[model samples]
Target: MIISSAEIDSAVVALAPVMRRTPVVASRVLSEQLSADVWLKCENLQRTGSFKPRGAYLRISRLDDEQRSRGVVAASAGNHAQGVAWSATQLGIASRVYMPVGASIPKISATRSYGAEVILQGETVDEALTAAHAHAEESGAVLIHPFDHPDIVAGQATVGTEIIEQVPDVDAIVVPLGGGGLLAGIAAAAAVHRPDTRVIGVQAAGAAAWPGSLQAGEPTPVGTMDTMADGIAVARPGAVPFAHVSELVDDVVTVSEEAISTALLLMVERAKLVVEPAGAAAVAAVMSGQVDVSGRVCVVLSGGNIDPLLLTHVTTHGLSAAGRYLTVTATISDSPGGLMEFLALLRDLGASVVDVTHSRVAGSLRLGEVQVTVSAETRGPDHQSEVREALAQAGFLRS
Candidate 1:
C-alpha cells in the first residue's frame, strides 16, 4: 500500500474541518544556538493535544458500515488513546482503548472524557496491544492500530503536506518516531512534494528499536523499554511503517533521557510552549547535537499531553542538568546561630536556599558539629562554583 501525495491531499480535505492547521513558527533562540534557520511545526497545539487525531480520524472514517457498527478497539501509551477516543466519538462509533497501567493520569481522564471505555492493562504499549487484540477478537470489533496500517500512514502524511505548504524551501524535517507512522508518512509526502527535503527520525535512546531493526532489515524488539518519553517508547517498529521508513527516511537518531528532559524544559522556558517529553524528541536531537541542523530545519513538536507531575520532575531535572540547581552537604557547628552563619554565607554568595536538612547525631559529625545538607538555586554553573568555593574558603568542609 503505497501512500501517495493524492491520498494525503484527500486526507487533508477530510480532516480540514476537524484538525487544526497547526502553525509553523520560527525559533529565534534555537536558530542562534544551532546557527540554522530553525522552524517549529507546532502540532503540540493540535486538536487532542497531538497529531494523532489526523491519522486516527482518517482511519476510522475509512471503515465500512459493518466495521463502524461493530466499533473499534485500540492500544496506546496515551496520546493515541485520546485520538482514537475523540475520533470515534465524532464518528458516532463505540470505542474501547487499552492503555498501559502507567499511562499519565491526565491522558486516562481525557480518553474517558472523550466517551471511550478506557482499560488500564500491562506496563507497556506492547502489553496493552495484546489485551486490545484479545478484546477485538472476543468482541468482534475492528482494531484501530495506533500505527502499522497504510491508512494511518496516509493520514499522517497530511502533516508533511502542511509542512511543504508552510515552508516550501524547507531543507530538513525532524520527527519523533514511535511505530514510524509519522516519519514514514512525512517521508513519503516529502518524496513527492519536496524531494530534496531530508526526513530525519528521532527516538528515545532507552527504547530505541529503529537503529538495530534497520541494521538487521527486520523489526527487532528491544529487551527493555524505559524512558520519560512514553509516547515514543515502542520496543519495535511497526512492519508497515518500517517499510516506508526504510525507503524514504534519510536518517534515524536517538536522544538520551537527560536530553529529552532538558529539551522539554527548554521548550517550556525558552519557547513558552508546554510540550511532552516524546514531543520534544526532535528538538532534543538538535539540542544534543545528534543531528545536523545547518540548514532550514523544521522540528515537529508532536504533542503536548504531559501530566503536571511529570512536568514538575522534568523541570527540576532540566534545571539541575543545566547547573542552575545545586545540592551540597557540609559540616557546621551545632551551636545556635551556627546554621544562621552558614546560611548567611550562602546568601552573601548570591545563592537562594531551596531546602535545608541538619543532623547533629550523624556518624560523621563531631560532638560540637552538625551535618547540613543544603539545596540551593544558582544562576548557572559559574554561580554554583562560586558558592562552592565560598563554602570551602569559609572553612566549611563538604562531606
Candidate 2:
C-alpha cells in the first residue's frame, strides 16, 4: 500500500496530543568530526523510549471497534513491544506481546508494566512473530506487526514531517533500518516535502538485508544474523516497507559492531544521551565514514530502551575499541609483592588499574611463577601502548 504525505500529515495531526514532539539538537562534536553540520533527532526521548509509539498508536487507533474490542497482538524484540503495549493501554484495549526469549529484561518488564500480556518465546524476532501470528489467529486478536502495514508506515512518516519543519534545510537524513518501516516512512515523506534531502538508511553489518535485497530486486532473508544491535537485527525487510524504500530511499549502508558500540559510547559521553545500539546505527555509519555527511545532516537516534547489562557490556567494548581500556595477563614471580610491583608499573605509566587477579596454578606458568591479569583504564591507544611497553621493560611478558 502506498502511504502518501497527506496520510502522514493526518497521522501527525491525529497523534499530536498523544506523542511527544521529540527534540532535534545540533551535535557539535559530530559536526566537527564529519566536517559537516550535524544534527540529532532525539527519538530516544520519545514516548516508550522510542519512535515506535507513533506508529503503534496510530495503527491501533485506526482499527475498527470490533478489532479494538478483540484486542491486539504484536511481535517485537523490545522497543516495538513496549510501544504496542503502551499504545494498547492508552486506547483502553487488551494487548498480547510476543518477544524473543533473549529480548532485554527492562523492555519485557516495561511492556508488562504497561498492562500487556508478555509472552517470551523463540530466540529471534522472526520466531516470536510466528508465535504472535498463531496467537492472533487463535484468539481473534488483531495482529499489529512492528512494520509492514500501511498504517504503521504512515504513522512513522510523521517523523519526517517533524524533521522537515525542524530542519528546513536538512541536506541528508540518516536513519537506522530494521524491517524498514521507519526508513520507508521518512523517505516517502522526504520525497514529497524535501525532494532534495538525501534519505540514507543504516543497518548493522551482521543483520543487513537491504543491501542484498536491493541488489536482488526483491526482499531477501538473511540466513544468519550476529550483532548486539538487536533492535535492527531483522532477517528480512517487510514487503510493504521494501516497496517504499526501493523507490524513496537514496542509499543504504552497513556499520560494523565495533562502530555501533563506539557510537553508543560517544553519545553517552559526548551528547549525554542514552542510546541503544540499534538507535546508534546512523551515528555509527557517520563515525565509520560509511555514509556521506558532507552536508547539513540529521542522524536519528531511534531508541534508548537498552538493558542495563547490555549497556555495561557495550560501554566496556566501546572503551576497548577506542583503546582507552586494556586487559593483559602477564607472567610474574609467585614471590610476595610480585602483584604489587606489576600494579606499581601500571600506576607509573599513568594507567589506572580497574581490576587485578593472580593465578599460581595456571598451566602456562612454571614452578614458582604466577600469572597476573590486569585490566586498566588508559587515556587512549598511545597510553595503552606506553603501559604495555613499561610492563615489558619490567620483565613482565604478556601471556
Candidate 3:
C-alpha cells in the first residue's frame, strides 16, 4: 500500500497517547556558525531512549486480537529490539527478540528486562533476522520487522509530522539512513506538504550504501560494514524506502567515523545533549561539511543508547580534537629539582597537568636522563603550543 502524508498523520495521531511528543530544541551555537536556524528533534529522549518505540508500538497496536494473542517476534542489533520488547510488554503480548551476539550488553539486558524472551543469535542482523523468521514460522508468531513493513514506515513518519509542527518553516530535514524506515517516512510527509523544503539523508561513510543505491535506482547492499553508528549501518535500503528515498530525498551524503565521534561529543559538551553515534549521524554530516545546509535545518537525533565505554572514548576524542588535552614526552636532567622545574614550566605556561608518567627506560633516554610523559589540559591548541614551547626553552627537549 502507498503510505501518504495523510496515513502518516493518522499514524501520528494514533500514537499520540502512547508515544511521547519528543521536544525540539534550538541549536544556538550551530545556528550561529552555520548561518541558519538549526533545530534538533530530541527523539533520543523518547521511550526506550529512541524513536523506534513509536513505530514498534504503533505497528504492534495495529495487530488484531488473534495476532496479539499469538505474540510477535523481531530481529535487531539493538535499539529496535528494545523498542519491540518494551512495546510488546506494554500491550501484554508475548514477544521474542533476536539480537546479534555482539550486540551491546545494555541493549541485551534492557530487552530481557522488558519482559521479552531475548535470543542471542548469529553475527549480524541479517543472520538474526533469518533465525527470527524461522522461529516465527515454527511458533505461529507474527514477525515485526525493524523497518520493512508498511505500518512501520507510516509509524516512523510521525517524526516528520512532529518536525513540521514543531518547526513549521523548516527549510531542510537531515535524517540518518539505515534501512530507511525513518528517512522514507520523513520524505513522504515532507515531499507532499513541505514540497519546497529539502530532505537530505545521511549515512556513515563506513556503510555508504544509499549513495550507490540512489545512483543505481535500486537497493544495493554493501559487502561489509564498519562504523560506530550501528543504527544506520544497514547494508542496503528497503524496497519501499528505496523508492521514496530515490524520489523524495534531495541529497544523500556520507560522514566519517571521526565526524560522528565529534558530533556526539559536541552534543554532550556544547548542546548538553547525550546522543549515540547512530543518532548523531545527521549532525555529523553537517558538522563535517559533507553537506551544505545554510538555511533553516532540522537534524533528527534518533537515539541515545551508547555504551558507557564508547561514550567515554568519544568524549576524550572530542577533547583531543579541541586541543583541550595534550600528551607529550620530555627529557629532563636527573636532578633533585628537575621534576619540579619541568612542572614549574608547565605552570608558568598556564597548563593544568592531568597525568604524569616518569621513567628511565633505556632506548628512550640516557642513564642520567629522565623521560617524563606529561598529559595536560589546556585552553586550546595555542595554549598547548605554549606549553610545548615552555618545555623546549627550559632545556627539556621533547622526547
Give the distance in Å from residue 68's predicted Cα in candidate 3 to where it truly belongs: 2.3
lDDT, candidate 3, 263-291, per-residue tens: 88889988999989999999988887877
Poorly placed runs, candidate 1 (over 4 Å): none
What's the TM-score of each model vs. the native?
0.97, 0.98, 0.93
Q: For candidate 2, what's the RMSD?
A: 1.1
Task: State the lDDT of candidate 2 residue by residue for 51-139, as single tens digits.
Answer: 99999999999999988999999999999999999999999999999999988889999999998999999999999999999999899
* lDDT (Cα, tens digit) per residue for candidate 1, span 231-327: 9999899998999998889999999988988888889999999999999999999999999998899999999999999999998988888888899
Clashing pairs in 3: none
lDDT, ranked from best to worst:
2, 1, 3
| Number of the candidate with higher TM-score, 1 or 3 | 1
lDDT of each: 0.93, 0.94, 0.88
Q: Runs in model 2 with CA error above 4 Å? A: none
Worst 10 residues of 3 by lDDT: 390-399
For candidate 1, the per-residue lDDT at 273 reads: 96
Whose lDDT is greatest here? Answer: 2
